[model samples]
Target: MEWNAPGEWTPAAAAEPGQPRKGILLIHGLGDSPWTFVDIAAELSKRGYLVRTILLPGHGTRPEDVMYVTADDWRQVVRQQADAMRRDVDTLYLGGFSTGANLALEYAYDHADVAGLVLFSPGFKSLSLDWLAPALAVT
Candidate 1:
């Protein structure tokens, strides 16, 4: 679990004492670990963003841990982490990969204060073969 553990990155101090800080909370997808965001977190940190990555409930541990996890479990973790991050930064962003992206979307829907979202490979729904009609027509 060493490599899969959650991590955080802090940006350099603000130029002015009263300047507001910007932060992002990244959630890893199902069957994935926080390591998925290591590179991106480093890049964002370099760009003056306070970045954090969380180990989703039932993740970063035994594979059996996910058996009892539910969507509500993940949602609660996201809500708690977001609230905590908001306390330290003036602007907050949520980012996610795969299933995590779906969770982020749901959170943003009810929380208007979220500054923005960065989603990658969102897992909103299963891909439909029906959408292939246009691509088949081109060929």
Candidate 2:
């Protein structure tokens, strides 16, 4: 029922019950699922982190789901989960790949409570259609 599912955010197994919680929320890119971070989450878990990944709405499902999805959909998911995690963990981090990184960046900007951010292949520049390029372009 946990991570064996394609898109579930399974907590790391090594975390203790009462320690100062350090949690990481991992997000996958377009057309991908939480499964993308399985190995990384497991490794982080082994290192004593509470690792959770989320299935952005319209993801881990049929391709048609993406066609109807919007930026608000992605933002809403990250916002809600990050907000919830902040209450549950002493330290909360957001890590993502590609478009997921874009969502994480925006969420981190708006939510300063986040402890740190881990991004891979962040794609906001290309996906933003040059709108965010002037200010956010990594290059």
Candidate 3:
């Protein structure tokens, strides 16, 4: 399945012919797009797993879009994708990078029965204004 969105990167699903589809959801990091997982997805596809990558609402596109998206919105997208994959695959795996990894963890926490999870460079903290309150107010 191909998902079109506003960005330089788009969601893609790749699977080998004749192989039973196995779902692997790849979530890109903050400000990043699904393009980050092209190589990873290709490698997994060669191994016969059905791999899918998604562009988070505010990522892989105009910066303005990011302003309009919230963490919950991203979560909704992941849920929708996982639901779609579950319909066809016997096993489902979730993976992500940075903030995307954080989202993946939240999803896994909610769906512990998932087949597996892969997180790359998970974001524990953000160096943005959202994180500055404590830093500046500490003094």
Candidate 4:
């Protein structure tokens, strides 16, 4: 529950570092942290990709942090992480789950140079917009 605990959101590297050919920016779902993407980031790292599951503004910390965060704050975090990763690799890819997927989509849409995307369980119309409106507004 504490920030940066074991298996928590902190950038990691492969056992044997390799040339950074591809980069993957992993994002977790709403109310979730980067722990979920650890394994995937490792696998991608081993495959010669620079992978990092960043700590979004409201994530990797106490849940209450989310209330003071906004969509723009989250987007800025992704942009900063993505920019750093992109500088070290050839191709950049965005991968995310749920709201993270929405962030990825928005980033990809704005940056046509993004190599590709890998979304997991992206939120669509099935998600309750009415219920989410209040949550989003507080941020």
Candidate 5:
């Protein structure tokens, strides 16, 4: 999948004029990029929805960058995208996977105007990195 660099943002595929939008903002998991949601976005677009995926801070370019970013950085990016979408569409939806889901939840909390949320493998709290030390060491 093609990846977007940090600080780079892309607009959602446009819908036909007068077509009511099902606006969706898709967030990628840790170490992943907006490209992760290409399939999902395509499917949503086919279903008459305007789907946009965002690359969170320090993601999509290098894994090392992700290690340097704080959770708040991620939250800010999601919030900015959500706010932009809210201004353009009639109904808004947020969705993501893993840590991305957490960011989505945080966005929803701040933006209660969203119509709905769709989470995949949502995380209520952080996962224990210590538990995966063995696997991480090998990688």
Candidate 6:
């Protein structure tokens, strides 16, 4: 659906006369689109937050588009979006799901000004060796 495309919501300044403006940039998972955060963004806006969701490189189009997409590409987009979001609000935060969660964590790690992170099932740790954990532990 067209509504699934990237989205941004900025609450009216009148919503909180003297409250500090807060913003959050959300990222979608490897095979997901900005749609993932649509509902969440709306809810955050109702609470006076400036919310944004962006399509990672190679996303919001054909699946094959991601075939050659690199982690660097994703990092670049997240960095840009976060930077822009920072400019729009007084406090900045990041959030994501799955692969997106990993990217958010990476960016926040180096950007201390980021207020916090809202991660959903971050995919950073490798589970490939988990299946062998039992056997190795027994040794």
Best by lDDT: 1
Off by over 4 Å in 4: 1-20, 126-139
* Candidates' C-alpha lDDT: 0.90, 0.78, 0.75, 0.77, 0.76, 0.87
TM-score against native, each model = 0.86, 0.79, 0.76, 0.78, 0.78, 0.85
Q: How many residue pairs in model 2 have overlapping backbones?
A: 0
- Tens-place lDDT per residue, model 5, 1-139, is 3667322222344435665666888998987777777777777876667778888888766667776778888888888888888787788999898888888888888777887888888878655776785677533
User: Across residues 35-95, which tens digit of lDDT does each residue of candidate 6 receive?
Assistant: 8888899898888889999888888778778876889999999999998888878899999
- Give the winner by TM-score: 1
Looking at model 3, residue 35 earns an lDDT score of 74
Give the per-residue lDDT of model 3 (tens digit) for 12-115.
34334555556788888888778778778777766667777877787655666777778899999999988877776778888898887998889988997678
Q: For model 2, how does the per-residue alpha-carbon lDDT over 1-139 read when each residue is reduced to its tens digit?
A: 4432433234554255666777888888888878889888888777767777888888766777776778898898888887777777789899999988888988889878788999999975554466765576333
Residue 18, model 2: lDDT of 69
For 25-57, candidate 4 gives per-residue lDDT tens digits of: 888889887877877876776666667776677
Q: Candidate 3: which pairs clash? A: none
Off by over 4 Å in 2: 1-18, 127-139
Q: What is the lDDT of candidate 5?
A: 0.76
Cand. 3 Cα-lDDT = 0.75
Candidate 1 runs further than 4 Å off: 14-16, 127-139
RMSD of each: 7.4, 6.3, 5.7, 4.4, 4.5, 6.4
Candidate 1 C-alpha lDDT tens digits along 1-139: 7568889998776455876799999999999999999999999988888999998888878887886788899999999999999998999999999988999999999999999999999967776885875677522
TM-score rank order: 1, 6, 2, 5, 4, 3
The alpha-carbon lDDT assigned to residue 64 of candidate 3 equals 69
- TM-score between candidate 2 and the true structure: 0.79
